[model samples]
Target: MERVPLSVLDLATVRAGHSSTDALLGTIAVARAADDLGYRRFWVAEHHNMPAVASTNPPVLIASVAAQTRTIRVGSGGVMLPNHMPFVVAEQFAMLEALHPGRIDLGIGRAPGTDQMTAAALRGVSPYLTVEQFPDHLRAVLALLGDDRIDAGPTARLRATPAPESFPEVWMLGSSTYGAQVAAALGLPFCYAYHFAMGSDVDRALELYRSGFQPSPRFPEPYPMVSASVIAAATTEEAIYLAGPSRVMVQSLRTGRLGPIVSPEEAADLDPELPGTQYAGTAEEVVAGLDDLIERTGARELMLAGTVYDPATRQDTLARIAKAWGM
Candidate 1:
């Protein structure tokens, strides 16, 4: 019966400029506002080679966001594991845990996080998008965060220290059943990307997770995090008015246009099919759509990404959404 925690998923879009600094400042401001408004966490997504989003390195962005806000957890909705070495990720997150103390989390994904072109640039020739190496990679990351050894020979004795006896809370991020099984087998919290991988079968994926769960040191019981898209507006009409530009961007994404995000004025006039896809409407309705997701999925958290362009309007929508659930 606990009310859900309100969180942010920043895709690092600049509200009014075209520089990384613009994106950084906007992100910091969003985090600060969310913190002041009593939200729980502020997370950044990882999308390599995407011009619209500047937060490719979540730890670096998390540090920046944490520095600006006195409270509020900051983390990666996930760091794609297939593109990097597990030990290095553990080290990076360990450093974050050191800097932020109890506010860091390390959500991991098995995908390459990009198309074939960007994937090749980031990972060279390694093939991690396949299901075969995913479980091993997940275990490797956990082991590196613990007392376990990474290298096996006499010269391979590497230990990650200042481990807090526990590091950042690790969550498995996925859009399919494969992610559920891996999270269950490893006994970590699982988060579903119902936000982008929209479908009716996510329930089945959650089922696979709960049924196969086994307790580990990190979690004595299965913990789930459900992620969904939100575009909260004051009057349903006004919310739609403010959400226009982002809707066009979503349209561009689906049509392979990948153009610059259109202005809000342009978006407000477009039809639903032209906007590509979304979860729009008033805050009251968004909560209703998310209600059974929390209960049925056994989610310990809900990560809502408000995909709007204007920072002021976006923050306003977030606060009202939090109040919608009485948070």
Candidate 2:
């Protein structure tokens, strides 16, 4: 099988004993490690009003990561477009691309990155702020970035200022066929969120993306990527041990009790049988599992999202995965 590109999706999780500042620093360290290890991209996730997640503003975090890493691409694993204005999103990423040049990507998602209450607070009580409006919002963002004239009465010819020499590579992020269809129709790269929500029919979604894809000026062909949770260590026991915290953290989020991610020692008491999306084992085992996932999804790139509590452990896991993949 051909080797697939490896990337990272970091949420900047705040560990139990650490501050949000520590988590941000950890994100930079992880990005640097991933860059040195030959990872293709380091993408930060946008999560709002979540105590455990510190990456509320993806563009700012992407800028910081881009400044710290030289070779690896830096961008948002996804910036949830529903939470902010389309023009602002376009302008922020335009600035990032202006500073980082060819190393920036603009991955946009339709969902709100927070709870319903927080989402309402972020978007305000606007009747037009519905998921159905994502396509329009996305189009507006693209127009601003591409310097295309808009049809709005007052902002007809408005363009996002400080536009880079080149636009950041745009990607449509989704966990369902809706996103696939939109991305395909728009001819942008699509990223499937298998790490968080693995929809029942991922293959069908991919098929829809490929079948409906139309050649665009920016993207000539379909490019699909999948993000999955990975936890690999030198030993199977150690891998499982390190993954405990992530398991607990996921459960907390799912149960609507968002809090700081606990230490592995603290997580040991949680139910061992609680289901999780993570793949945890030795390097060889993890590689096999990830290979199977890639094969099943037909993804050209794999973005690993591991929420290990310790920064050092997280970096070590990424290094181990890189070595196993022979990157």
For model 2, the superposed segments whose C-alpha errors exceed 4 Å read 126-128, 147-156
Q: Mind sharing the TM-score for model 1? A: 0.90
State which candidate has the highest lDDT.
2
Clashing pairs in 1: none
Instruction: Give one digit per residue, the lDDT tens place, for model 2 in 82-156.
Output: 888887988898899899889999999998877788888888854246577888888888878883433443445
TM-score of every candidate relative to the true structure: 0.90, 0.95
**Candidate 1: lDDT of 250?**
72
Error of 1 at 314 (Å): 1.8
Candidate number with greatest TM-score: 2
Q: Candidate 1, residues 1-327: lDDT per residue as tens digits?
A: 578676777777755346767777878888898898888778887888766777788888888888888879888988988777667788888988888888988989888777877776776754545335667766777777772433323323554455664578788889999899988887888888878777556888889999999888658788777887777776777766666776677776777766444557766666444442255678887677678667777676788775666667668777777788887
Model 2: lDDT to the true structure: 0.86
Off by over 4 Å in 1: 15-17, 128-132, 147-156, 161-166, 269-278
- Native-to-model Cα distance after best TM-score fit, residue 195 in candidate 1, in Å: 0.6
